[model samples]
Target: MSSSTVKTIQDTLKAWKSLVFPTFKVNDLLYFFLKAGLAVSTFALVSLFFYLSLSHPSFNSSSGYDYKTFKHLVQQRTIADASAGAEPTNVSHILFGIGGSAQTWNTRRHYTELWWKPNVTRGYVWLESEPPEKENWPETSLPYKVSANTSSFKYTCWYGSRSAIRIARIVKESFELGLDNVRWFVMGDDDTVFFTDNLVTVLAKYDHNQMYYIGGNSESVEQNVIHSYTMAYGGGGFAISYPLAAELVKILDGCIDRYSHFYGSDQRIQGCISEIGVQVTEEPGFHQVDIRGSPYGLLAGHPVAPLVSLHHLDYVEPIFPNMTREDSVKKLVITYKTDPGRILQQSYCYDLRRNWSVSVSWGYSVQLYPSLMTAKKLETAFRTFQTWRTWSNDPFTFNTRPMSENPCERPLVFFLDRVESVDGGETRGSYVRYVDVSQKECDREEYVPALAVQYVNVSASHFLSDLWKKAPRRQCCEVINGGDGVDSAVYVKIRSCQASESLTPP
Candidate 1:
């Protein structure tokens, strides 16, 4: 080989040896591994953080997330956790604000006292001014608080009373108190009689941590239309969830002036809530009672829900005949205490042997019809009352069946006389025949058999409050014993409907 070629090959071999067999000290190797370990750990940590930010609802808002969206997500998570883990809502969690006037509070206080349990129910009666004899305030009545002056706010509703402005601020004032553990702010007129057990049952169905505006609109379409169908009639009472009330109080006073053209306090509240993008969650149990006549038909065929509140009591006739309004209310309240879950719960069944159709309002009354009636017709309320404004027969919020003028066609009516708890959480409600001496008696032979039946004994198992959480269905009824009209009374049993059973007539 040439001498130049040999020298080039020798240099290449030396370079390859240096590249393939490079040497390193022990400390250098240790330093290299430490750097590699730190890089791996950093990569793992970054991956873990990203995973948590994307997957976890309770993530930190500062970690590159839209703050409002993050806040909403966190609130949703918190509400879900609260609804699942928190204690059940009770009367102690509800703060009531009853709008009253010193001039009329004395007479109206009776209605409030009926349901208000001193020290048990938390709330105040917000008055226009200090009531007469404030130092002598009855222990049974709700503690009174004079509402903050609302005279500065404009109320342009020509037909509506200015008292609405003061009443609208009661909610804001109630929230400002900052009471602890209050889940609901209930607003009502002093005359509204709340069935608190039923009220709690209804409220328990919802999560108070979330925004909720729960109530019923006026029974009269005209009333609803004049105000707003979306508004919860304040007289009937409406519940504002704590979260919603917090938001409402912030903007309510400003909203009152903005919605000055609104007719009622409820409308103004609804107007404010609407700006917040929440809607009224109408619960049929809240009764505005915007009717001019008898509430019998309405009560007897109550919608299949708990009776939350009843308003306009003084405007209508006593629920029972031949009784003072106070006494009538007392009677109903007594029955309500016996079976709050079952009060006004309607159930009807047929005695095929005697061709009798019996409709029982568990804690109220019963009707015995000699002829067969469809379940739809039986469930539909009788038009014994008229609209509040026009005092007309038509245009009610619910469907009503007209009362038959013919005595023979009408069913024999009965009213609840007594209710008692029996063995194993069962309730026996006895209803006595109600005879209207002024009206003509049904002389038909078929009706005579029903007339002989003077008493209806209805037995029902205690209705569990949790049943409200389920899809609503009316309880089923069966005639226990009405043997060939020989017995002076009929017995009936009301129970949860079997899966296969239905209210279809034979």
Candidate 2:
């Protein structure tokens, strides 16, 4: 090695020694360890916080699965074990099995479309066959499914159509679809108009996990006698809980054969459910509309329960006068959208100064009697409709007052005209007087003042959905402003009755 290279190597070694073995004080070492400990402790605490957040029952996750969903799925157990199901029942949870046939669906689809909110509502309209090749299926309507052949099933009821067998199987096919999150199976005719929000309100009252057969019987006593009064009249629509549906589908095909002599599909279903030992849980909102004429009397004095479904619409007069059946239903739907929980709800109060009794059927009509009437008499429906089969006036599910021949004896009727939402969750509905040319006007001085009133304005708070969770009670109304005998409009307010309030004459 050259002497110059050896000198350079020696200098490099001395410099490297100085850099590697640089001196450190005791305080410096202690500070370094302290920082390291703090970092490790901080990391441990952060990890623990994250773990606790994920594990907590009340914690909600926006990123992926929720706590209840995760626990229900991963742990394979129900949330709290006391919940109605995994969650509150919604439109999606109730699977509607609409019984329709190719022959009638074309016309009946109009009724189905009026209430069917596409995408938001779940289920199919089960038809006997594909619709006509010439007509294309509209995306706006519910998707159609051809029902499985039921020709092999025994159906021997001489008066009943064989179609009842096919319709009864809709429940079976709907269950077989294996849709997720279904808690209730609701069956309705294609022509039946369902107030879906109110239907949910009704269904949510019961536990979906339990076996329940929930529906209403026919309004006509004769029809109820012909069919089983214990059975739910299917056209009014009926809800079967998921637990009940699970059991029903298992024996439905055999049940059909067992009940071959039954006259209606609803009767057949009732028979099958009877075998399972579930009784009909009657809800007043389901109306079979087994009346032959106007349904005005029936709806005006609706039961305290929310209106759920109305069936046999084609057999009755249009709900509103001077409108087609479709238009009348649509009109009611408009008002219904304004206040679903209040539709067909009857509220009445007396105008003592004016000597008038006012009955308000929220979102439907108002009846202003010129003279004071007892609450009991006002609550009873007028006999504007007749028995479904024989058109007799004698029998109905509810008490009815016979229409007085004298025009002065009856109250002046007003029909809903317009409804709009107000600030602070209130609704304002205006009703116009409904006058028939065939009806004679009373010339009595007592009737003159009431007849002069052309408009009825109703104000009410938007109904709370949770109110149905509590006991059902008829709400009360007050005449906020009876006209000064000059203005043609009168203002009424519908409100929840106070704890001590009662409808007694002052």
Candidate 3:
């Protein structure tokens, strides 16, 4: 063989040996660095997670939150703590304390089924005329059935002139029959429309054992001002706990004589209630929609609170302004018959102004957006809200809409799993796999579109409730940025894991 060929082959073999196997020392040193890099990455992720949990609870996945990595933190508190108001103990609840005029049966008959008949589960309709001895009233819409039987109350006060003051007698008469068996006594005029679902919810907030005179104020400042702000307007209806009802019955007779000069039954009742030292604890749902103009104004700004009753609806302006009262009524039936909740929310949710301010501590506020991502008790830069307030004095109002979709409604902070996509105008991201953040089970691992300054109101009362049944989604608004940094997003716990079944009424 040629010497030149052999020399080249020898050199190639020597070079290939070094390439095939590096010295152990060199390889081990290189391996150490690779392992160190991996360890550092793991440490950083752990620390990031820890920081999110402790210091800043809410986080935007911008620092690296993705749908797969985002996990919803388990709630620390139980559902019972969140729903302290609506806990249904062993008490049997009652439905009504209806007060109708004896002289107006013919005129009132049409409205009887419209309001009280369909909604009331159990209670009496106290009428001026002989209470229907027959278990059923003449047929009405949907043929509303009476859970509570009707009974007439006898009174000496003549009709027309003394009709407004008759509630006093009605109260005494109702007291005469013993209401100690029931927990709540709901009072309303025959024409008043009551949303019993909301009424019950509002009542649940307070202890039945405590004297709760729950209701709302009148539209007229003069009326509220003339009477003490403590009085709940009658048209909107009012709730009295068993204890309060028992107590009020005792003083109502004596107080009625003193307030008899008042123009209407409502004021007289208010006077009696107030005299008993049981002032009206306001629940915005009991609206006094007594204005002469369009109901749209009143309906548009309906409170975020549950609706107890809409009084004088028969006497109020057209529900749909510009239409005849009859036409408005027809439209209202059509509008609300299918989904009353949506209709009510539509009436109230739209046309809200940002006159109110809410604080968000942890969520990222995009460029030029209002602050977003507040928890139930987030201490925002504004030292914002203690528990989701609408204005300075109002926790909720028709004029204000809260961000509902963000899971930060609870005081717990949340972190974003990651930004899945950013479209410049809007950012698509996934929050941690939370128990109640996603409204739909389908959307749990999905990417959600988010933007800054756009406050969105989720109608859900709480996140956990959204899972089993339809919850009230808050009004739609914008999300701002986290106060801390661009990488940060609000990490929050939506609600306790406890489901609604836990609070089932006894």
Candidate 4:
């Protein structure tokens, strides 16, 4: 036709190409749909992961990989405020594995209320047989029995005692029951008394979703060698995290059956857990008090680590210098009930329930409460006191002359009494160095001649006696390693000396 007609056709073609050109090439409609689909899939997957994280209180391996986010999530999971009427951060239960026959409940039942009830509210007593609930059911209403059968373990406990054999099953059954709400399952013997609050605090530090076998080793070198150090000593008790507990419940029976060569429950359980590549996370709180000497020094001076449990309370001697076995048990239990934290934090200082005053600022000093005993007189009184007292390890301390000056400059008492007097004859450094409770590394202090007392300052028998009546807010110690040599001793000044609180023994 004409040039105008050709121009009109070209314009129409350009307009058509602008609208539909891309649609004709490379399946543009399909590509657009595919991009939309990929975006929706990515968003859905992210949402699913977030939803899973919210649903699970603890973390999994994938969640653990997100370091910062996972840490924040963990903080939220375990922050418990009992001050706000909330329970402990780690919701835990104690499966008190007692291997008693029908009669063991007679005396053992009493300890349940005194020790276990206050701390482990969610504890259960696992007995070989059900306790008699009626006329002669001892004196307790604790209904913690789970199972009594010897065949509870899939394997026959070839070398195990009745107690040793059933441990596997006891743990399994307890985990099954506690699977829902309990974040941790703590296994303890009936005599095991736990500082449950500390236990909760300790568990809060770890992620519940990760497997943890946490406990203390035995004090016995022989026992530790015979059994692997990886094993948790049974008396002190141990804790398994929720995720680990779930995993163990699934395969522990099988593992136990395989490890029939093991003699004890602790060894058997350790073997099974080790298969899952979990190492024993040692926490010092679970004490298997195998040491025979008084745990007074240990209990009074726990070095600020959380005091979780003390085993064999009945078996140990009196913690105080002079007290009946029965009275000592009562006293310790009472002290723990009063303030477990204070006991651990102030593990360094203790009382004799008598008339002398001693304190440690950075260094230890002695002050005779009735009179300011000179170094000679102080030694005489302490020596005379030692004659009657069963414990004589800690001796009175004095500066070069006497405690005639203010006792505060050198608080007059120390938990670690001097093993030897600095000088039998009075001189410049006439003093004694006791086992310093503050020095955790050494058995005894290096040396001393008394220093300026700063932190602790108490005076008079009556005042000192009543000082700890109301629990102190925290443990107070000079935190000095006392000695003559610089590296050897913690240099502390004496503030004051005080006597024990005069509370009547219940």
Candidate 5:
């Protein structure tokens, strides 16, 4: 009785234990499934939130709801009910800060010619050195107003080092003088000159009302620099719109004591802007080409067809030693001198434009070709153009059908009649040869005596007269060409030559 009873009791106890505790395997499986479901739900919720915020107009940043005050303003003005005809005020202004060494001062003149002259009305110039003791200074005969303001620091060790202090003073004074109309602040070295004629017009087209900052397209700033979440590269030529500028000033004013120890002005500015949670607009065409060891191209973006500006920081004196008051007053225009031979062979043109009115001699020439080639002659030309045309480097390129694409065949004639022959000695038999990229081979022949031809060949595919017609007329050298290849392709060539003796009327 005891043995049988003991076995039954033991089996009963085991069964009871199994029912109460359950299997370890089952518990583990259940726990895993529960956690997986929770994780999936959490992820889905987060994704849904982001998606809703991104796609729906109510949640979009462009919608006023993204910011509290912006929303209130829009509501109060009944902007939501307004028609499309309502135009918002464009609140962008160009602010330029000028200071530094004699070279820096000279650079300012070029900036004046390129940027200030064409675009902006107000700017600040901080004199690094006392203006040749007022008594010894030359009489003020320039067209633009030149004011000499003293700096707290007598001598700045380097341009970058002193930029912050100079900028601080200029910014503060600009704000105090009720000059709040400025929406963008452009800070750069003095020697910068714009190569392009249409930079201001282009910028005006794109300056939207936002906290944006544009910089020169250079790797140096991108890699080595830490920009504010909202701003970057205060040097070279950089622009910060009004709202950003105002916000930056507020942050700087509040945190000046904390960031005072930072040596780099750009770093300090970036740090402060980032701390405030602003976003930076990495734009092309703002640069500090004057910086030592910088790239040959514009730092901010692609090159423009016309130059915006160039930093003449290095050769400021020798280049403009004889610059006169009259030169400053005269309206300067750039005329491109092209060698057609270079255009056909290299699919590029060696072109140079110089302002005869100014004594400034240091200028850059460009070689431009089609955009399709790997050699990137057009890219180089555009970059060079932007470097001088805009305060920064930016190339404005648009795609269109090339002259070679046309079905009709016509002879491309490059007329040299408008060119004033620099070579006085007249030799009759000399002729110039040019390669025609529009044709498969350079077999086509067109001849004009050396005396009659000023420099190079024009592709039959292109008409110099057409280019001249579209170009700004003043005084220019006309190149004329006609041919079957002219239907689909366009070409530019570069040539080495002395300055032209005469410029044709447009």
Candidate 6:
């Protein structure tokens, strides 16, 4: 090569190195600034997200408060003071009317089955504006004034049937009359008979500070049904607190239009109250006594017995209808020895058949005993053995027994056999050896014999009664009596037996 060409190439190489090396330093500075800016931006975004999440309105520190404190706050907001014209004693009894023939209304009166009347101060009836002209209308006493409103009929198809509308009208009228002070609002159909005297006393024992809506019975709603909420059976003798009623009325008045297509008044009320966040206490004794095949003859240890108001009105001939109001009331008046041995033998075995893995054998033995049997069985036995015992011995006595039979003069006896101990210690055996019999037995005397029994626990009896009252017919077998050492348990099992034999009316 030539010397001049070599010098030109070296000059070009020197110029290119100076420009490229200087630009490389500038690119490094730019990359450092870009990475630092991204890190700072990420930190700021995360901090903002956490702050917003913690400070949101729905997220409150109050959620950590104890249940008692939260409940107190709710009570203060919902319930009014008894002295502030919100006293439960202000009104008594919520009268319900079932829409049907006049004969149905007459049947209710003849039965004298409105259980809430004695507990409440007044009663009201919901009826069609015009009375049905029927042959069976009673000639004597009619307790309630009939109202004639058909606005309820418009939603009949949606609510339930015509009978449900009748109950709704009665409820609406009771509310309109400012009967919220009435502690127990007994609502049900005409066919029902509420006869328990202990209902008011039982309700009085619960803390009245909180607002509650008690239902007589509940029914499941079909999944495919269209409405604001699924329907429940508020028709059969349901009671609600005045505060709950007020809240329900507000919701009803507001949402009635949107749910105009919904027909049943009970359903509408249930939906409205539910939306307002009122929970339902389904007590036993509240019943829907439809005359499908036979009538429920006796009333013994029925849960709703204390708060019952009958519903679903129907009538039948004296002979054809084996069970009469008099017969039921008579059973309530009698006191018979409930044989524990028999109760165990006849009592339906619920846990034994279903929950054998979890339950102890003793629970099974107690649940099926004569005294702890199904409601129907107890009722029938009481009715059949009415002559065997005296009314004075009954806890809730109102009458005496016939002179021909031994007046259940024997003191209540309880037999106890020592079973396993809690810590596997020595077993204990005891029995109520003797109890003095007396005519004036309604007081301490009545319960003394039963109380004397070493094996029988009053609390256990009450618990069993409560379970029998709340459970459905077939479901009664699951109830257990365990106070000695075993924990109370329930089991679901299928029963192959048909309904028990009907009780004979005296």
Count of residue pairs whose backbone atoms collide, per candidate: 0, 0, 68, 38, 92, 22
Give the per-residue lDDT of model 5 (tens digit) for 48-145: 66754542234456534545543343342233224123443222245565544533444345434544443324565555454444345322211222
Model 5's alpha-carbon lDDT is: 0.37
Write candidate 3's Cα lDDT for 1-506 as tens digits.
79898667656655654686445344454466679999999999999777544422223344243433233211211222243455473223654666665456556555446544443365555554554434555644222222222223223343334555555455545433433345667777777766654565566667776777888876654455555466777767877765566556656655666765566667777777777677778876787654543354355434444555777766555554345655554444343333233233321011112211232111111111122322221211221222111113222222334334544232222222223222332223333322333443223211122222223222112112122134443333222332322222332111222332221111
User: What's every prediction's RMSD, in angstroms?
Assistant: 10.6, 13.4, 29.2, 15.4, 19.4, 20.7
User: Which ten residues in a row are the worst by lDDT in model 1?
Assistant: 56-65
Write model 4 residue lDDT over 359-450, tens digit each, in one string.
22111232313223232322221211110123333321211122223333333343322211123321111123333354332112211223
lDDT of 1 by residue, 130-193 (tens): 8877989998999999988888999998888999999999988886665667788999999999
TM per model?
0.84, 0.83, 0.48, 0.55, 0.44, 0.42
List model 6 lDDT by residue over 111-230, tens digit each.
444333444445644565445643444434334556545453444254345544445555545544433334444555544444433344334434444566665433112211332223
Error of 5 at 204 (Å): 2.2
Which predicted model would earn the best lDDT? 1
Off by over 4 Å in 4: 1-101, 118-120, 134-141, 152-159, 296-301, 346-506
- Order by TM-score, highest first: 1, 2, 4, 3, 5, 6
Clashing pairs in 1: none
In model 2, residue pairs whose N, Cα or C atoms come closer than 3 Å (at least 3 residues apart or on different chains), thus clashing, are none
> lDDT value for candidate 4?
0.50
Candidates in order have lDDT scores of 0.87, 0.84, 0.46, 0.50, 0.37, 0.38
Answer with 2 or 5, whichever has the higher TM-score.
2
- Stretches of candidate 3 exceeding 4 Å from the true structure: 1-92, 117-120, 131-136, 139-160, 179-181, 321-343, 346-474, 477-506
Q: lDDT, candidate 5, residue 110? A: 43
